[model samples]
Target: MTVRTDLLIVGAGPTGLTLGIDLARRGVDALVVERADGLFPGSRGKGIQPRTMEVFDDLGVLDAIRAAGGSYPVGMIWQDGKRVGEHRMFDPAEVTEDSPHAEPWMVPQWRTQEILFGRLEELGGQVAFGREVVGLTQDEDGVTVRFPAGESVRARYVVAADGGRSAVRRAVGIGMTGETVDPSPMLVADVRIAGLDRDNWHIFPPHGEGDGFLAVCPLAGTEDFQVVARFPEGASVDVSLEGIRKVVAARSHLAPDDVTEVRWASGFRPRAALADRFRDGRVFLAGDAAHVHSPAGGQGLNTSVQDAYNLGWKLGAVLRDGAAAGLLDTYEEERRHVAADMLGLSTSVHRGEVRRGEATCQLGLGYRESSLTKETRATPGAVRAGDRAPDGNLDGVRLFDAFRGPHWTVVAVGVEAPVVPEAVRVVRGRALESYGCGVFLVRPDGYVGWAGDQTAGGLGYLGRFGGR
Candidate 1:
C-alpha cells in the first residue's frame, strides 16, 4: 500500500516518536515508520537529563515519565568483595522554580520508548511497523521512499531518526566524521541478579592488570539491573547468560549462580560522531542519526528527543502556519552546533575529563548564536535572546502552562506587550526573578526567541515566525 504523510519519520525510537507526537498535536499529518514490529527492549540509554524532563513536561508525557522512572541511585563502590564506600555520581543541586528538574532521572530506554509510543497513539497518530525503507528519492517539493515489502510513502519532509547506522542517511549520501572514544569493546546487558541490593548502583573496579571495571545499576521502576562491563581492547567478550554469570563471578565476589537470568544483551565500541550536515533537500537528520554520542553522559537519547522538539515546530510553522520556508533552514544552523557541542561533552565524560554535572543536565543549552535569535535590548537582563525561558509562577499563572501547546508566546514581564495575532499566546505578569523584567518571546520549543526592554521590538521577532 502507498501512504501519504506530511512528515515521514523513519524510526520508532524516542526521536521519531517524540516528533510524531509533536507534529500530531500541531495538526500536522505525520507518520512514524519502524523496521521492527515492536518497541526496543533494553535498559541502554537509561538516563534522562533535566532539560529532557522539561521537554517531556511540555509534550504532556511528564506524568507518565515520572511515574515510570526514578532519580539516579548513589553509587556503591566495592573492592575484594567488601563495600568500600559510597560514591555520588552527580553533584547535588537544589531544584529551583526556574529549573524544576535538577538531576538526571533513571528510566529504562525501553520504558521511555513505550511511554512515547503511548503518547503518540493517544494523539491519534499511527506508526507503521516492519516497514523498512530500501530507497529514497527527493525532488524540489517532497520526498518519496520505498520499501521491499511492497510499501511506499510520499512525504513533504522525511526525517531520518533511524539511528547511528541510518538507512535513510546512507541512502541520502550524508557523510559523518567522528572518532572512537574508547577502543575497548563493552558489553551491556539487562540481567536479573539474586544477591544484589537495588538501593545502590554497585560498582566493581578492575582487580588486576588489563581488567576492566564492572557496574551494575538497578533499573528504576523495574526489577532488573543493567550490567555494564568493559574488556581489554580486542579481548573476546561474551554476552550469553552463562558468560554474564562468569563475568559477575570473576569481577565481583558473587558466584555464577547469583545471575538469575539474562533478559537482553549487546556489545559495542564507544563512538562519538556527527553527520557532516543536518539537512539535505527535503530530508533532515535527527537523534542518533545526526549525532552519535558515547553513552557516557546519557546525552544520546535526550539530545535526540530535543532535536525532534526543535524541528517539529518549524516544520509545522512552514507547512501549517504559513511561515516562510526559510524558517526551515534554521533547523540545521541551530541544531548542528548543539549536536557538535554535545558530542564533545559526551566524549569528555567518557574519558573522565569531565564529571556528569550541570552541563550534562542540558538545562542551560540555548540558541543565542542562531540567526533567529534577536537581542534588541541594548542592555541585557538575566534572560536574553537565545536562552532557555526559565519557568516560574507569576501573577497567578504558570509560565510553562502559558507556553504550552503548539503556539508561540509573547511574555510581558514588567512591560507592555505589543498587539499580536491570535496565533501567538500573550502572557503578562510582574517582574520575574528568572526571566527578569523585559518583553520576551518564547518559541514553540520553549526557548526565548526575542527579548527587549519594551514591546516595540518584540513584535518584529514574532513576524519572522509568522506570529505577528
Candidate 2:
C-alpha cells in the first residue's frame, strides 16, 4: 500500500502526535505512523511546565487538561522521609501578569498522550498503529518512507519523533552525541502503596542498608503513586513486583509486603544524549529522537511537545504559504540549542542541585536565528531576544484577545516604521517594551522574530524568508 501526505511524522508519541494535531488544525494533511498498537502505559514525565500550558492553551486543549488531572502548585523536597524544601510553581513576583497561564500542571505522560491523541482525532488526523518506519529515502523534492507492513509513504517533509531508540534517526544517519551519565539503573514502577503519601513527590536518599534512592510521585486519577528507585552502580535487580518490594523495603522503613498491586514496571539506564544535528534535507528530528536526558526535572516529554509546537507552524507555513526553504532550517538552529540546554539542566538536577526558579530549560529557549530577528543594541535580559515572547494586553484590548489563534503578529511601536504588510497583522501600541522594542514580528508558534528597530534595507527581514 502507498499513501501521500504533506508531512509524514515517523512516530506517534507526544511530539509527533502534537505536530500532527497542529498541522491538521491548520488544514494541512499529515500522516503519523506508530509501532505501538495502543496508547503508551507507564509514568514517564509527570510535570507539565507553564510554558507548555501556554502552548496547550494556544491549541485550545488547556481546558481539557484542566478538566483531567491537573498540576498542584506546591511540591516538596525530601531526604529520608524528612522534608528539606518546598517549591511553589508560580512566583507572582518573578512572573508578570501579562502571561496568561503562568503555573505548571502535573499529569502522567500517558494521560497527556491520551489528551493529545483525542485532540488529534478531533482535528481529523489518526495514527497508523502497528506500523513502523523500516526505511527512509529523501531527495530534493520529497521523502520516501517505508514501513514494516509493506507500506510506503511519500511526503514533502518527515519528522522523526520515534523515541530515544529512534529508527528513523538512525536511518537518516544522524549520530547521537553525548556521554551516559551515571547509568543509574533504576526501576520505575506504578503500583498501589499502602502508606505512601499521595500529595507530593517524595525523594528518599540512601539512608543505611538500601542500595538505591526512592522517588515517589503521585499519579493523577488514582490513589496509587509512581515509584522510581535507582539501584547501586552496576547492581542488577529484577523489575517485577517482588523486586520492587525488595528495593522499597531496603530503601524505606516500609515492609516488603506493604506493596500490594504492581500496575507496571520497567528498568532503564538514564542517559544524557543529543543528536549532533536536528535536520538533514527533507528529514527532521524532534522529541526524544533529537535528545534524551535523565527525567530529573520532568522535562523529557514537555521538551518534546514544545519541539513539535515550534516546528509544526514553520513546516505548515512553508507547505501552505510558500515560505522560503530557509525558514525550515531555523527549526534546527532554534531547537538544537534547546536540546543541549535540556541535556545540561537535566544533568545538573541529577547531580543533586535544586533548580529553583523558572526552569531555564523551559523559559530561556528562543529563536534568535530567524531572519526576522531584528538588530538591537539592547543588552541581554533587557530585551527578550530569542525567548518566548511575553503575552500582554494592548490597552483597551482584552487579554489573549490578540494573537489568540494561530497567526503571525507584527507589533510596530514607533511611527517611523514601514507600512505594515497585510500578510502580517499590525497592532499599534506604545508598550513595545512589554514584548521588546521596535517592530516585533512573532511567528505563529509564539516565538519572537525581529523585536528591535526595523531596517531601511527594503524590509530585508521579510526577504530572508521570502516573505512579503
Scored by CA lDDT, what does every candidate get? 0.92, 0.76
What number of clashing residue pairs does each candidate have, in the order they appear? 0, 2
Estimate TM-scores for all models.
0.98, 0.89
Give the poorly placed runs of model 1, Cα more than 4 Å off.
none
Candidate 2 global Cα RMSD: 3.1
Residue 342 lDDT in model 1?
95
**Residue by residue across 1-468, what tens digits does model 2's lDDT show?**
779889999888889888998898877889998888987887677777778887888787888777767655355666655688875533443456556555566677778889999999988998988887888899999999997768899999999999999998999899998887776688888888887677776667677664577877778766668888888778886888888888887777678888887988888888899999999889999999999988877678888989999898888778876777778887887788878987888887777674634673376566666555654535433444455767676545533555656676665554345664566555666664565446666667776665556535425655454353
Window of ten residues with lowest summed lDDT in model 1 = 459-468
lDDT of 2: 0.76
RMSD of each: 1.0, 3.1
The residue-level lDDT of candidate 1 at 59 comes to: 95
Best by lDDT: 1
* Candidate 2: residue 411 Cα off by (Å): 2.2
